[model samples]
Target: MKDESLIFGTRAIIEAITANKSIDKLFIQKGLQGELSRELMSLVKKNNITFTYVPVEKLNRLTRNNHQGVVAYISPIDFYDLENLVMNVIESGKTPLFLILDQLSDVRNFGAIIRTAECTGVDGIIIQKKGGAPVNADTIKTSAGAVFKIPICKVDHIKDAMFYLQGSGIQVVAATEKAESTIYDTNLTIPSAIIMGSEGKGISPSVLKLVDQSAKLPMYGDIASLNVSVACGVILYEAIRQRL
Candidate 1:
């Protein structure tokens, strides 16, 4: 992790928010109270920043410097606007391929999926801003620098992105074992975004209802589930194979 990835102190964080820095997440002292803290809270609300209240010990673990009861992890990459990216891809005459992560919690899985997305020529990746993994140091490390090569959009909700993709003629395909059809049976050559759920829970029921299609990988053994990253790579390559 780079040293600059973290920035503490209430004033510095406020300034970063005002400057529109992409903060992955923020940790604030549980019972922090001060005029500067009040100002910082105002800025956080104004910018709709994602943050959580934590113990002072957690803040200390994040940084040893004088944090003034706040610590922020800066995102290493700039996120793309989902609608704009979709429009750009459509206008460019290329069949847009995307990946939508549904509250995926593992940073390494997110990173590996990103690397695969870049390698397979995915147009962009979409994730909800509030949940799932942030593109922090662990994400960047596992992505093997591919995070810089791809455009990742952070939307407010997964369903919103799914609706937008469907409206724009892109199919949302959910990767889960519940599907009657396997990835080989699905048509991946078309404009589509494959949605992978979290490691434990499959796709959320509300979200599963909205996808254009649901797909599953073949289950030959007693083990029914594959790691999310490995499953993502498998499905993506299946798409590639179909396209080829």
Candidate 2:
């Protein structure tokens, strides 16, 4: 209904899939039995596109015009290749500062962190392919267009990302409330990657184990933790402070 939400015909949707466009989700009217529908389903499966089968009435509600029982939500931001971005950063003869999000699902929080990460000169942001917020217009607006300026790498898993970063000579630091050390005391001057977890659960145990170091922000208030985005700012700026 909103301008941010767009509807595409079946051919346009297929073109989007073929073009590797960032798609948040796709919708197909339920019980649309056809050869073209089978091909669409095959493409969706191949591309790992998230889609929902809904009643034709719901499709009509989404768009007044003929949607051909198909519509897709396109994402505003483009993802980067993690390994290439890292290699480029290293080849530039500068220390790489990467931020990794472990299962962070809140869209606004993610946007806020991108804004901070960009300001702090973070080289890139890494997020898991699944269990993360879809990058949409809200993220772009909330980031104040930082999403365009900063590189975001979507990875298959957090642990795999940690492994690659570590193997590449960057220290992997896990930010968690459970850490024994405070971020203020930890050393961040080295080329490093920081992992920020979800709002509810902290970093996954498997991921935490792979980190080179674990640190947390000191809590002095009644609340046990700060919002993920707020914590990201404190930690990232602290890194910037330490580097400068």
Candidate 3:
């Protein structure tokens, strides 16, 4: 992470929050107590921002400057409003195609998924606010600048987005190896959202329950699972093929 992507010092961080800066994460020194810290905590709670209390050494490791036991990582790109984007897509008389990522932590994988989403004409990509990969320089480079071409929405949880998409009459599909059905058999030629999970865990059970359908890629080789980005590409392009 570069200094440009970080907001250091207590007051500076508070100001950033007040100004509505897209902070990816916040780190505060453990056991720090003061009026400023209290105000910061109030703001963080009011905004529902993700934060962690870390040792002073951890803060020092982030920046050598006088950070006043506070540092916030800023998101490189602005996040889109999921509801408005969905409405806009519907009003445009086009079937909405969205990609929802559940706790995907790898930056390169996220970037690659974004690139594929752009190529497949996906309307937007949704990710959980806390666990998803940050849109930073590395992600931008990995996507070959495709990140800028796509709309990314960060929500508090993936399940909520899944429900909203379902309520809107859009089919929500999950890509998991545990599924008995294959992606080719699923009807992806309508308003749909494909939910891909983290590299380690396929998909959270809670989220999987909310999906309209679960589909998996057929595997003939030795590997039980494919890389997350590769799986996403395979499924998304499958949707594209059906639509065409």
Candidate 4:
């Protein structure tokens, strides 16, 4: 956080926000009031940067130097263009296999999904920019170096990824408990993108409608559903089984 370039003063933070830097989050001293503070808060709200209002003591602990009532965490991963990634994969002369995470914010879950997708030979992983976990050190650690080798594309919306996949001739296969067919019965050899939803809400309805096929993982025990990462492993390995 103290890399000089990463740590910014009040004016610097405002400039970075205006420049559209990918800030991970923001921290502001509690009860601080001024025109500049108001503008910063407005900018944070408009840019969707998570902010925590804390006591001055907390800010002091964060940085003894002059923080000017604000600090922003810079993102670790550089995002790529989803369309460009899809096109590159297609041009490489391989059947496309993509995994899309719909609002899956858990870092370990995201990392585990990346590991599974890499092991299963998925062409790419698509995630939404804001709702999902940032590709931070924890994600890289949890992914066990898989994140370095795998291609991950972050987009503004999950539905945009689905539409692009469909336009590129990749069938959208959504994994959900509400689906009629089981994952085992679903065909996976075709060029496809598999989407797994967040644990609580499941896949968003708009994305669900864009899917060409929907299948669920079977459950024999009394437990209703699997963890998002575990379910991702099962479905991705099913695709690997089919392709092999």
Give the per-residue lDDT digits (tens) of candidate 2, residues 1-244.
3766575678778888888887777889888878777888899999877678888888788788778889888877778999999999999999889999998988899899999999999999998776788787778889999999999998877888888999999999999988999998888999999999998987988878778899999899998999999999999999999999
Off by over 4 Å in 2: 1-5, 29-32, 52-61
Residues 1-244, model 3: lDDT tens digits:
4558888998999999899898998999999899999999999999999999999999998999999999889887889999999999999999999999999999999999999999999999999988778898889989999999999998998888988999998999999998999999999988999999999987999999888999999999998889999999999889989999
TM-score: the better of candidates 1 and 3:
3
lDDT of each: 0.92, 0.88, 0.92, 0.84
Q: Arrange candidates by TM-score, highest first: which order?
A: 3, 1, 2, 4
Q: Tell how far residue 199 is off in model 1, in angstroms.
A: 0.8
- Given candidate 1, what's the lDDT at residue 230? 97
Model 2 has a clash total of 0
lDDT of 1 by residue, 27-66 (tens): 9999999899999999888878889999999998888889
Error of 1 at 186 (Å): 1.0
Candidate 1 stretches with Cα past 4 Å from truth are none
What TM-score does structure 3 among the candidates reach?
Answer: 0.97
Per-candidate TM-score against the hidden true structure: 0.96, 0.90, 0.97, 0.81
Q: Count clashes in each candidate, considering only residues at least 3 apart in sequence or on different chains.
A: 0, 0, 0, 0
